[model samples]
Target: MLRVCSVFLLAISPLLSLPTGMQNVEGEVSAPILNEDGSLLIKSGHKSSADWESFSIAPGEHVIFEQASVNSSFLNRVIGNEGSELLGRLSSNGSIFLINPNGILIGPSAEI
Candidate 1:
């Protein structure tokens, strides 16, 4: 006889929707730009021992992180304020760590 066990994890929070036609922009972390359409672009890169000292997103805005090329082990962490939405397209082995007290919504294009 063979048996299998399954485990499920659930997060309870309000539903947030992602914006349409978001684009990726590459740049340094300190100089983040908010486009005219209310979307924020994030450049692909790695930061070591970096804290969320000045990272924040406003309400009703969408943030998109871009990578030069898909790297399976790419990892990025962002600490956002309440009432903002984050969206990204990650590699199969990529991972993102976000800390938002209010809430967050993952877009459909996210593989992980």
Candidate 2:
């Protein structure tokens, strides 16, 4: 059934490719964790940052960010060819500076 296939994909997604739409190009940021609710959590260390190849958030998806401190910031640069589409929730405790020369689209339902 479709539901079974979806569950199987979710179970094996981590082994196939990056779970979230983030691929770090630099800095010492941990890999994105796919939460039980299908949300994405990213944790960065002290004075640390990261650059991404592609950064996007589809509808119904939530991306949460946690840094070393409230003053700490993580810089994410999108170097991929396509632009970014943010149509979901982006919750961050610290600061998240996203740099995408191509484009950055924040949908109406997006929450920062």
Best-fitting candidate, measured by lDDT?
Answer: 2
Q: For residue 101, what is the lDDT in candidate 1?
A: 56
Q: Give the per-residue Cα lDDT of candidate 2 at 8.
A: 97
Considering only N, C-alpha and C atoms within 3 Å, which residue pairs clash in candidate 2? none
Cα lDDT for residue 12, model 2?
A: 51
Q: Which digits, one per residue and each the tens of the lDDT, describe model 2 over residues 1-112?
A: 9999999979854432222356665556888888898888898865555666677887677888887789777888777776778877888878888888989888898888
The C-alpha RMSD of each candidate to the native structure, in angstroms, is 12.1, 6.2
**Backbone clashes in model 1, listed as residue pairs:** none
Write the residue-wise lDDT of candidate 1 on 1-112 in tens digits. 1222222211212233332222222333333445687665545454311233223332344555554445412233334343334433322223345444555565554333
Error of 1 at 86 (Å): 6.5
Residue 102's lDDT within candidate 1 is 56
Counting clashing residue pairs in each candidate, in order, gives 0, 0
True-vs-predicted CA distance for residue 33, candidate 2, Å: 0.8
